[model samples]
Target: MTPNILMTRIDNRLVHGQVGVTWANTLAANLVIVANDDVATDDVQQQLMKMVLPDTIGIRFFTIERTSQIIDKAAPHQKIFIVVKTPQDVLRLLENGVQLEQVNIGNMHYKEGKKQVAPTVSVDDADIEVFKKIKEFNVDLFVQGIPGEKKQDIFNLI
Candidate 1:
């Protein structure tokens, strides 16, 4: 059976206190999937995430392509909360056949060329263009740091 996708979020900080505790509890997620190429192979990063995550919640680190495949075949009981480092990763998952109806923009920290869109979100020219492409897939994108925070439409911020 197909897994129930609780939430798909783009947070540069893949897994941390806010995500492992606050977001996980709010979403009632059974599994947290960090679909990031770099972290998938980084044993240290994976271990750090494991340290903060509650033992009740399951976690997986996977390359974007692998996440796209496994998500589709996940157990019926799995309620997944997916987090990726960038919009490009989410786009890649879409291209690889991972279905998503909406994506939450969270904590995209500012970099040199990136413009701060929301307090917690920043985007460069390339990111803006990639976001536009994602919109074409009919996926809704909004910015919200936590469960009850007001969601701002990503396009409006960009």
Candidate 2:
């Protein structure tokens, strides 16, 4: 009963304004899965994300392991959109056998040691390494803040 993973994105903000409203609408997603270990356990964060999501779209929070498990049990008609905090999480899912076809780099804002790779994406050395690893998996990786915007291949920036 695996769900069709319509799209997978890496945005540190997870289910924020643009993601909750715009991206979900654009993808016509019925389920929005926030796959992250930290946020899955934080009640406050979970409540806040739920508040912003449109009632039309269902939302779930799970750690990488649980998320992978759900992928197999997902209803066949469910159109799932996955959002994670970092490339590492995406890598974890990929390593766990999730059949992700493409990954969008929505946003990875600047951090103390991270370097800017795009206007909306910044990564540290470890992140760069993970991005490289992601590429090796042969999953298409690119950056796009919203639908219709240009997608920059992350490998070029690394």
Q: Give all candidates' CA lDDT scores.
A: 0.92, 0.92
Error of 2 at 32 (Å): 0.5
Give one digit per residue, the lDDT tens place, for model 1 in 8-44.
Answer: 9999988999999999989999899999999999999
Candidate 1, position 134, lDDT? 92
Compute the lDDT for candidate 2: 0.92
Candidate 1 residue-wise lDDT at 13: 89
- Write one digit per residue (lDDT tens) for candidate 2, span 1-158: 55699999999899998999999999999999999999999999999999988899999999999998878889888899999999999999999989888999999989799889888999898998898898888899999998989988987887
Give the poorly placed runs of model 1, Cα more than 4 Å off.
Answer: none
- Deviation from native of the Cα of residue 105 in model 2, angstroms: 0.5
RMSD in Å for model 2: 1.1
